[model samples]
Target: MNADLIIAGAGPAGLFSAVQAAENNENKKIIILEKNSSAGKKLLISGSGQCNLTHAGDISQFFDHYGENYNFLMGPLYTFDNHQLMKFFKDRGIKFRKARGGKIFPESNKASDILNVLLKEAKARGIKIIYNTPVENVKYKTGRFKIKTADKIYKSKYFLLAAGGKSFPRTGSTGDGFQIASSLGHNIIEPQPALAPVIIKNYQFKMLSGISLKNKEVSLWRKENLIKSWSGDLLLTHQGLSGPGIINYSRYMQKGDIIKVMLLNYSKEELENNLLKKIEREGKLNLLNLLIKFPIAQRLIEKILEIAEIDGSQNAAHLTRQERKEIIEIFSNLEFKIKSLANFNQSMVTKGGIDLSEINPQNMESRIISNFFAAGEVLDIDGDTGGYNLQAAFSTAFLAGSELKERL
Candidate 1:
């Protein structure tokens, strides 16, 4: 074999795998191949340029963010929890600070600093990485694997595919990993856009374009049924909607479903009573004033009032029972018809990849192909925002790297 191991993709997973492999086996030769000119291009934009390094919490908490795949992550995450990852980065001279919601970012809050730290670690270990050389495909023969680029072919005894998902093509995560894994007898789950902004068809939302609601609960409903609800800070984008609440809740929203917006972040009963109390206290207040208390803009308030058939300038005192009910309906569950989800190309994290069942969670190696391994977003596991995805990458990479040691 040309090398002991070849890792595809140069993001956090691949880079950390190279570094870990070198540290675990001194005689092991590792090489990382990245399609981009420089490594960690995606890393440069992670956490909005802050490079949220890892989360600080229990392993169960980390896995819970992945929802259904929580159990599948136990082996990898327990092998290397978030605290161990933080210590590793600190050892590499990368300072991190805990931000809101246990999100740990580099103290400098620059993605470059985090990238530089990984680059330095990989370099110090004598790990070979080729830049701008995209892997065209991989062909397995007999037992070893063949890695083919545009102009060269490399053979390796062990391989770790970390090519990531289709999101962020410019950063080199163009679903190349999925193709490679599929060809290697691994099941490939169709990728979907998670943590992406939603498409709202209601033009009334256009009036709230600049308004951002803090601590608001956003829910998804299919046929007047409650599916998912997320409460956090939300922002109204010019196109439709975004922010923590909307983005998190969007994962459960399916095609052709209408999303309901609750600006108060209160429960069903709480919101109902709150609306009734407001009407009783300020009977003469304009509709705009009542909505402004809930964080929506005045123009959007007027639009909802229009949709409710209540005069925008009508005094709360003079409002009839019918008019108040209509207004209450609009406020309690503002329906923003969901046209569709934003495309995968613009999503923060790709929702699917290699199927988890085919790989051994304890080692992150292909169940069908012994010498083959998988890690990072290339795996079926994904997570919500606030440093879960990166932790998954690290945890899986650690398993792959550590398992390689025992195998040898």
Candidate 2:
């Protein structure tokens, strides 16, 4: 064979797997085909260039962050959890610090620091990384695999497809892995934008672009049925809604879905009672001044009043019963109909990938195709923001590498 193993795409998964395989057997010939000019293009831009590598909490807490396929990932994550992943870099002389929400990043606060360390490890292992060579096709017959690139086809005893999903296509993750897996008779879940911003059908919060709320309740609804509810920090964007609260739940969201955001962290009854008491006691106070007493930002409160068709400058005493009820409803339950997600270009990851059932969690190998393995966003696993996705990539890649080592 031209090489013992050929891994497609040099993102975190491919690079990490190559290092793991090489560390196990130094003489094994491993090649990584990276479509980009440099390795880890997406890795360098992750966490806005800081590269949140993993979360700080226990591994058990990670399961719920990954939506549906959480069970399928329990094996890999447990085998190579966050602590081990940290030690891998820490031993390599990279210092790490934990940020808010348990996100772990390099002490240098640079994503290049993370990418450089991975590249350094891969280089030290004698693994060959061919840049600017995209895998055009893959074919397996008679115990050997052929990987077709633009220039020529290369053969290998084992093949790993870690080309990533269709998020951030500019980073060379243009759903090539999904297409290749499909060609191999593997089923692929329809890829959708995950951790993406939501555009409202008639967004009126453009003026509150930078406004944010903390620990606010966010609910997802289809028609009149409540689908899911969670809480996180939210940011009002020029387009619509964003931040961890909305984007993290974007995987479960679709066009025309209604999202209810609690602008004030109080129930409708509580808000009505509180507002009525305030109006009765302070009849001369301006409506805006009364609302400002709540936890919400003044600008957001003004906009909410505007949306409710109530004048912020008007006195609380002047509000009719209907107007008071309308203002209270807006404050308690602000609703937005989702027009669309921000698309793959703006998404942090892809929601769906190769069907998890087709791959063994113990080995990360394709059950349908012998000697073929898959990992990272190429599989049907996408986690919440704040280092979960990267952690999943590392865990799954390590598992694949472990199995490859024994096979070699």
Candidate 3:
């Protein structure tokens, strides 16, 4: 089999590129090869099936959401931004609703709606999607590309490797793109799980699994030095720590790194002074009762007391100065050592992929090999949660598709 352009994977990147390429130059014969039996398996489960397509804000804000490769994605994101992507779907009669943190989702709250629209558009433009066909190998020979599947070797004049990274292995994004791109002389940065929950060492909050803390600062530390910090809602899971606060920065975390959760918004001195004044005013009040008055959950305060080896039944008058100092320290800083990040199956995205140096950001084309392009998680780009990843995929796919007409 042969075509003008052969796109690997039918995720957001491949499907969006096929639609855009078909629209760019009619009768170009674009085809998308998907390993899954259907399209957008990962997408279908995104945002718990709500499919937050993009963020509802100025495109400039998107730059900070992507980590180190924000500079590389500037051109593509600027070209077809969140507004343009929203307009594209709105034009198809899809209604949208904005959720917290500027997350834009379909009003119907169904990820299938987003997938169905893309499929409809693809079908409308005669862009064929061949499912259950995973490319085993990719080769360029004599100005033509050869893609090998289990039973056949297909050829195309141009190729797009958007097979995605190994985040969800069951969803067909099992790092096939890395192997394919590596075979075609592209370097792949070793892929690791991103936006994954972390298992904590000696986690003492086992019973506090469902507890959530809002608007807290979580700082990452490497020994005596502070590495990085993020602020968001944090959840204590049965496994360990999770939520946007931890998961967003989990890419930079390694086993044995320490994470400090700022449970209280107070300095050591400030809390101590306030507690001293309160103890003076209410000397007979229970120490646990005094601590609970400072905007912390009762259960968390009790756990902290337990960890600090202080009896909650002790009155403020009976609380020794040493016990007071220990409680204050625990209240201000709760430290946990990371055991490990969740595996690829549990990760929301993959952190690293094909090295970005060989790919041109202008049109998502390979600088080393002409007519070979890539987009989405297959590259060394992972965005924070809340529609950034999907937006990156669409923007890069659009950039690739908009320039495919020139190659044709």
Candidate 4:
């Protein structure tokens, strides 16, 4: 098979790139080869099927989510930002809404709608999509690229390796792109699970599973030094913690690290002052009852008391100065020993892939090989949980697609 451009993997990046290429160069033949039976399998499950497409905020602030690789994406993100993304869908008659934390979602509340829009655009542009065709190997020589599938050798003027990262293996993102890029002289970073839940060592909060706290702060600490911290709603899982706040910081955590959860957003001094005020007003109230008066859940209050080795039935008046200080300390600095992070099966995205230094960030093309390009999680750039990663995929694909003819 011969085409102007052959894009591997029909996920968001590949599909978006095809659409862009087809729209810009009307006579160009664009083909997307997908390993899955259908396209957008992982996208369909994003945001629990609601599909948080992009974040709604200042374009400059978007760079902060990618950490050290922020500068590498500055060009792509500025070229096609979240506003342009929303406008692109809006122009196509796809209605969307902004939710809490600036998360943009389809107004219909279905991920299928987002996928359908991309599919509709690709169809309208006459882009060809081949399903269940995985590229086994990629070769580049004499300015033309040869992509080898199971039963065919497809040649293209330009190639895009968008097979995605190792996360969500069942969805077809099994790190195939890493090998393809590696074969072409691109450095592949050791892939690790990011945006995943963390298991606690001897988790005592199993009884508090299903309990969720809003506006709580979670901090990662290593050897008495604070590594990173995030503030958001937290969910207590059977094994440990799972929520935006925990998942956002899990990428930087390792085994034996400490997770400090601040149940209440209060300093030790503030908690002590509050406890003094409560004692003055409700001196006859039981210690457990006094704790339950706080904004925390009743089950968590019981658990905290249990950890502090305090009798819940004892009145606040019976508490000694040391016991009061301990109670205050627990509420301000609840700690959990890190057991391990959940594997790729449960991860939202992969942390590492094709190293950023191996690709031209401005055009999304391979630095070592001509006519070879990549985008999305296939690269080492992974963002936070709030639609930043998807935005990166779309932005990088846009830049790559726009530069296809120039690459040829």
TM-score for each model: 0.93, 0.98, 0.98, 0.96
Q: Answer with 3 or 4, whichever has the higher lDDT.
A: 3
TM-score ranking from best candidate downward: 3, 2, 4, 1
* Per-candidate clashes, comma-separated: 2, 0, 0, 0
TM-score quality measure for candidate 3: 0.98
The global C-alpha lDDT for each of the candidates, from Candidate 1 onward, is: 0.80, 0.91, 0.91, 0.89
Model 3 residue runs over 4 Å out of place are none
Q: Which model, 1 or 3, shows the larger TM-score?
A: 3
CA RMSD (A), model 4: 1.6
lDDT measured at residue 62 in model 3 versus the true structure, 0 to 100: 89
Residues 283-343 of candidate 3: C-alpha lDDT, one tens digit per residue: 8988888878888889989988888888998888899989988888877788999999999
The reply for model 1, stretches above 4 Å from the true place, is: 265-296
Report the Cα lDDT for candidate 2: 0.91
Model 2 misplacement above 4 A = none
Model 4 whole-model lDDT (C-alpha atoms): 0.89
Ranking by lDDT, best first? 2, 3, 4, 1
